[model samples]
Target: MMVNDKSIVWILKIYLLIIFVFIFMPIITSVVFSFNSDRFPSLPLGHFTWNWYDKVYYDSETWDAIRTSIIVALSASVLATIIGFCTAYTDFRYSFRFKNAYLALALLPPTIPLIILALAMLAWFSKLGISGQIWALIIAHTVLGAPFAMAIIRLRLQQMDKDLESAAWNLGASEWATMRHVIIPFALPSIISALCLTMAVSFDEFAIAWFVSGLNKSVPVVILEILQGNVDPQINAIGSFVFATTMTLVVIAQLFLFTKKPNNH
Candidate 1:
């Protein structure tokens, strides 16, 4: 038994190490390549420089794309977060018919192939005369992101105690007052998580944005365009910046959630 247990432990450890390396190898390679001084990706390793980073920062087109992406991400995240909060709150706080079906539908977007949805949206948009506009992209992104936000908020709401709301109501507080004063406070972390996740999704979204964004260019669309013509260190530089930004935001959000002062009402 002891030998079998030892073998199993070793196997699990090896498996975990392999999985970790497999997942991170591309990321590590990309980060390393971002600092490569050579114009070509295959250039030998000791040529490190800051030129690519400078180019990434200084290029007007790249900056424009980045600005566009940020605007779309912020808009879509805020819209999706609000829609998701309302959806989750309704499902949890009230009894309704077809609630299961509603939740299943909410989760369907992430499960379905993105290509199919993008194509469908493209067809619909073509008929509506608004195909390829920023509003089109915003609507697509909101639909894509709201489901995920709802699911996360629902999970967090489940973990929350309902007595707090009930107590607030019992104190002669109105429903709106209880929600504003009590429910929203407790759900802040989940709200922040949903916002972060939605922003990330909107920021990196490619397929739907490609279809619905029309002639307007976003960072991902610009990145795709850049890739079609040439392979440059700029790709790695942009990726490195995205990676760094994502990591920093995730760290800050986690720390804020975990270290926040508890609400003692």
Candidate 2:
């Protein structure tokens, strides 16, 4: 039997709605729990309260975890963005030996299952005597985050106007000058997107951080540590804050992308 176009459209809409609902269910629950006055996150809904959030704000340990997470995420994201931009720029602007091989290798890190990647990182860092070090977490996150940054920036670089840089060079601009004057401004949106994504990745990183963390913990690692003991609504509270900020940045990155799109019009 053949389906009508309207029927297909309705089915597709329903399917998408179902998918989105499933995707957001955990987030919705977490947000709800964050506001719950209950000691633990469970049903028999407790009185509505913002007490958990207040705790999250005032708790010194929470702040410490946040600080550690911010430091690692910022460091990793910046390193990733730099390396990603350089590799992407090279792939787009020049042809070199083993170019395809190198691109494949660049993409390889993200392809590894993160659990496996974390274990592999542990082994690698152990050989270098860096296991259980804070920098080890940063390095592992950089490895994962850079591939995503490279993927985003690479696509943006490909979509950029080829003539602009050439025009700058034709006008006697140095390569650095052309990059600064013509390319960087054009690629700014993609750069922002890459940085935001890497920041989120680094912030949420768990397996690698669990493996490589010394005395310090990323926010996710801290949460995991807390989970081992009594489960608290504060976990949900802090989680809500974490989710809000990271997702907000992701949304902003997406908006910036809309502004820098290739003029297909």
Candidate 3:
């Protein structure tokens, strides 16, 4: 008996469609519910209203969370990118004792579960008496984002041509000057993409922020606190907005930074 290829294709298409819907079911529900005039998330669909968006805009706590998230993400991503690029550049340029071990340790954080890392950071910071400080949250998130950033930038660094650095040095450029002109320029794409990834990770990270944030909280922690007080559609609206924003940033990074080939100058 001959297999019907058209039927198989149709079946696979339907299967994929089902999977997509299943995955996005909650997100779709939230988007639809965000415009819901009624207080409850699900049930009879009510008349469309912008009240939730307006509420989010007017809510001081929501604004505070937004401000905190922005500051933390910016500071953390920049620091992570700088640190990651430097580490990757160093590891790539020169051989040292325990190089493999150092790379392994640097890459370990992304493998560790966030909850475990969060607890560890909380304990460490508590011992240092910095557990409740904003700096503590910033440091934890920087560490959390560094592995991913380093891994990305490291890949670019590995692919780089070593002759460029030699040429710069031959032209009488100092090590730092050569890096500024040659290495960093060649690796800018990867660095930018890594920074974007770090920003998104730091913005969305709840576990570490929650444990170390204490009174000062990022957006996710703030949202959790709001939920504990009441079941509000405003929270859903805020969440959906955040989801959209993060997705946009990821998509932009993928399209503009990752897809394009970096100039190897």
> Per model, how many backbone clashes are there?
2, 0, 0
Point out the higher-scoring one by lDDT: 1 or 3. Answer: 3
Candidate scoring better on TM-score of 1 and 3:
3
Model 2 clashing residue pairs (backbone): none
Model 1, residue 165: distance off in Å is 2.0
TM-score quality measure for candidate 2 = 0.92
**Model 3 segments more than 4 A misplaced:** 1-9, 263-265
Tens-digit per-residue lDDT, 1-265, candidate 3: 1368888988999999999999999988988998999998768899999999999999998898888888889999999988898789879899999999998998889889889999999999999999888889889989988888888888888887889899999999999899899898888888888888888998888988999998778999988998999999988888898888778767755764665575544
Off by over 4 Å in 2: 1-4, 261-265
Q: What is the lDDT of residue 157 in candidate 3?
A: 84
Backbone steric clashes in candidate 1, count = 2
> What is candidate 2's CA lDDT for residue 66?
91
Predicted structure 3: lDDT: 0.87
Report every candidate's CA lDDT.
0.83, 0.87, 0.87
Q: On a 0 to 100 scale, what is the lDDT of residue 230 in model 2? A: 76
Per-residue error for 180 in candidate 3, Å, reads 0.8
Sort by lDDT, best first. 3, 2, 1
